[model samples]
Target chain A: MADTQLEADVTVNAVGSSCPGPLMELVGNAKDVDPGTVIRLQSSNEGTEPDVAEWSEESGNELLDVVDRGDHWDLYVRIDD
Target chain B: MTANRPSVLVLGAGAGGTMTANALRRRLDADVTVIDKGRTHRYQPAYYLIPFDYMELADQERDTRELLHDEVSFVEDEVTGIDPDDRRVEGEADSYEYDVLITAVGNDRRPDAVPGMLEGWNRTDSVYPFYHASAAAALGDAVDEFDGGRFLVTVPDTPIKCGGAPLKLTMLMEEHIRKRGLRDDAELVMTKPGAEVFGTGPKAPYQERIEEIWDERDITFVPEFTVSEVDYEEQVVRSAEGDSLEYDLYAPVPPQYGHEFVVENSPLTDGGEYVSVDDNTLQHETYPEVFALGDNADVPTSRTASAARKQSHVVVDNVERYLDGRSPAPDYDGYTACPILTEEGKAMIAEFDYEDSISAPIVSRLNWFLDVNVIPSLYWNVWMRGYDPVP
Candidate 1:
């Protein structure tokens, strides 16, 4: 999937936050949104990528794509029902 | 020897062990004994400031015998193995038996774990692993003499004690360079194996504040750059990802791991490097009589002295309950505090528990004073003496 093609239902700006911060924010927002809701998490912390991927797998959510934006990362996740 | 008076054996007279032993001595009628190889107990928190000559090694050093309560027995022996099944710990000098065991033998520094790191420290003038006392003192001289070029600090990809220490050291070095009128000539750089500078979870506020501070100071932060080797002869550090950076001076936090006795000899760790304890109760999963705290415990939190201080309280309470034939309480919430010194007189107290951040992420002189001036004194007088009113 292309980075610019998909539109997120919710966006979490977690830039300048580290490890569990981005992941925590993602989890927090993911809980409030609907099951099929697509969320975009932008984070500068490098660990967030793997953490989000692991969380998605463990939580049974769909990780759409991970985009490198030079300075930060954009991770798209579809919440599971 | 009697059912009424149980004997407690504590391992390693470090922060957690010392505090727990002293507290247990006062609270319970049980006979408490602490076994450690070292005669001197060094205040490890002051290691970061030693490079800047903020605190002396002598001032931080105290005899192990002096720290413990008079009623508590102090055994000077190097632990060779631990037999949880037999309720015994084998030391180099002799084997000791115990009714209850608390393992707090903190992690070991292994510069040799990384290729060329140990060689770099020995052979080159530039390489200084500042976690060690001698290296910290030597870095002071190196810092004094350094005029220009890249002043780099690297954190190893390990769950290190005081996770915020590398960040504090990096920022302090940047400030030092600026103060010496070498900011324009020298490049300040810090590398971590992970993406963040300080950490994540409830540390978002502090991490954000640190990012802003680093940006204003022009201190470069390199993420996911795990140091593979230090080419001391060429004055360059190569990362596992094939990236290399040349430096004029380097202070690297050495790779740390649990002692072989705990991980290899004892079944307490349950095949992990550290003593595998319940994060909340701090009791060994398989052995109810076994408890672990401090850097040695596999707690999902920053392994700071502050965390150990808090854990000490819970461990003491749980041990008391255990002696009274009660179930251990889940008291420890993974609470830890890191006083991040942004500059000489400025710091931010990043305090947090398992789920959330508790302290405001505000940099101030008061916080700096609390960390540098008050904490050390309190550590020696109150906390070490087992008179922790705060806990």
Candidate 2:
């Protein structure tokens, strides 16, 4: 069943964060949270939209709330079970 | 009572648009109106890593309203047509006339420009363009499913925002798979249209650095090739040189060209269709009151934000000067900069202009940190605010 419940959430500032840096932040934060946690990451990578979605889905995590703020991004990823 | 500041109009809210808006807001006393079809702004340079599932989409945007000074007028509307004869811009819902117009409407990636691109993009994981937001994310998904095969990255036959981006993706992706213990399982390949990594001038140090990294990594480099079509079914990508590569995951950078709308409508555009403006002054070739900056204009240099920043100053000065009936001689030298990330925590800062290359940093952890850390802060707190200095 799809875990309909979103438990905890946090936001990361990936302003100039590109590539490996943003991924490092995501992986590092995901480790600290319990299962079913959704961390909302905001980035300015104009290229982040499809990238975050693909990553979350590929890793078997739920990705949601992807928005473009012109120069930055807001994305939500649910921690896997 | 009047200091002779020209009433300026700027279109679009991308890097060039914002730079012109902020720079003019600070320099000229004239009323400035910035028109953007959308309210959200995405810092495009940061998108290179989305395919690795490295960054979140939310981190890429900011409110256009927040980035502006209180004096700069922000109008959210899509332009329908430009009436250069009468100095007017027609939008979907409204029309506005201006004494001086700054055309900074950045180009969008028209996937339809290529044959079968949209369908091939939606259908397959073997091919993608990193420059697009969705393509980068899709690339990330493809990488996750990648069990181990040839990983191909191709550059199209055209000018793009950042010339170093494709190479950067190759480096970062290599690092990602290596960390995952799949280095031996996957083969990394680079296909580009340029004869060398960066074909621009002042190229010794940067070229040597890129050549060094090309050899150090197992990444294969195929130069002077253009991707003609995508055979998604067979998972093979064909190039102009008649070479085909079958891949498990393919990331291709699309060829960039001038914005068709302005080029087609305006007689000021060159035959190939880019806004023709003074290289130094950034003023229109025919209309003194009209100016352009960034990717849309026919500036003979690498189309990067760095070039835009320098040009923004000249645009502001000339606008003010044109109104004052004074000569505006603020000349831009076509300087562009991109800190090429050779790898995680290792970057070769390549800063160059139409003539000279400025960034030749000694290899160190500091340079890498600048690309990954410091530049982000600069882009946000400084450059985006119109304070990016000229070197």
Candidate 3:
């Protein structure tokens, strides 16, 4: 099966955060989760959604889904390595 | 001595040090330790206007106590030594150990950098360096009482916080003389060490603007002339290259140097005597637990508060990584920012990284407005609070 949130073992909640907040939160939480688990980042910094997801994508993590809920964004990423 | 929490000792409470302490407290749960020698913290940018009644020096300074809160453990003491191997910093009255140490002790203006800079300062009113709060008061007195003559500003072969400050004073004085209807009577000359006016090539708009003002105001530009002597009595400034410029009113920026504690304590500093850290990680090359930022770091860039704010991110990140037992992700792009104030109304905000690359242009009033009003408030509020607007 294709690797996605469906096969994920972890989830990260980085809600109510902004630019560096979301990224910082994600980076900090990324260390604790097992290598294959998924981290779901939620934040209101619309400007940093693509940035966070891109950072995750480049750093050996699989960006599963990015959803903008107007008030905030839910960035889903599965830690591949 | 008996804090309930482990302390994070921060040395120096100036722009870089203050920002580092405040930012650390806001981000981490550890106890914050801030040490500085002075009871008063002066907002230095306002010094440019103090001579011309644009701002007050007293208004620029704040009770250092008013700036700190319950979040930080404040110590009014001068830093004497730092035992990085022992992880302790020696203050005037106490020695405190730190879980993490941040060196924000900023640069000091040395009147002795040039041979006769200090001598001229005491011997004549014609020579003044915009290096301290006192210099502004002295220069203000000089500007107000002068009737008319040649007002000269010489920039030494050293790096200053605001690169354009000396020249900015030159322009404002030209405006001051013009307003006083002494344009024909007063001749303004800027003696500088560099070839360009604004430093960045992209800021040609600013360079052209300054040159235009120089032409219109009849202010002469002397480039690459390092000041050698200040003959207060003879009213002459001799460049090290044997060039000479005469002036009735002379303003110069004193040479800057690193703190003695750092130079004497650590082997990290170069001949210029700054903490030689990798610009991106901000961690000491030989020591991982030690990190430095701001004016003290030997980062080849314009030393300004704007640069410090950007460096704060890198410092914060590397510190967090070190706390997490992971190798630092080196990502500091040597970002630096400066707001070149053309006048009371016009300001050009310049932001760039290690390459003199422009991050933001001078077109926006928001950035200028940030420099004039917003950033200063945020510096006192958020930056001092250990919180940064990182978006």
- Cα TM-score per model: 0.82, 0.80, 0.77
TM-score leaderboard ranking: 1, 2, 3
Task: Estimate, for each residue in B182-206, the C-alpha lDDT of model 1 and write its tens digit.
Answer: 8899998999988898878888998
Candidate 1 chain B, run of 10 with poorest lDDT: B116-125
Q: On a 0 to 100 scale, what is the lDDT of residue B223 in model 1?
A: 93
Question: Who is ahead in TM-score, 1 or 3?
Answer: 1
Rate residue B391 of model 2 by lDDT.
Answer: 50
- Model 1 over residues A1-81: C-alpha lDDT tens digits? 778898899987766443344665576566456799999998876788888887788678888999999767889999984
Candidate 2 regions exceeding 4 Å error are A1-81, B1-6, B389-391
After superposition, the stretches of candidate 3 with alpha carbons farther than 4 Å from their true spots are: A1-81, B1-6, B200-205, B270-272, B359-370
lDDT of each: 0.86, 0.73, 0.71
Task: Give the per-residue Cα lDDT of candidate 1 at B29.
Answer: 92
**Clashes per candidate, residues 3 or more apart or on different chains:** 2, 32, 2
Q: Candidate 3 residues B72-126, lDDT tens each?
A: 7788766767777788888656888887777877776776667766656644556
Please give the C-alpha DockQ score of model 2. 0.05
Kindly indicate the candidate among 2 and 3 with the higher lDDT: 2
Query: Cα lDDT for residue B336, model 1?
Result: 95
B126-191: candidate 2 lDDT, tens digit per residue: 666667664665566667777888888877777677878888888888888888899999888888
Most accurate candidate by TM-score: 1
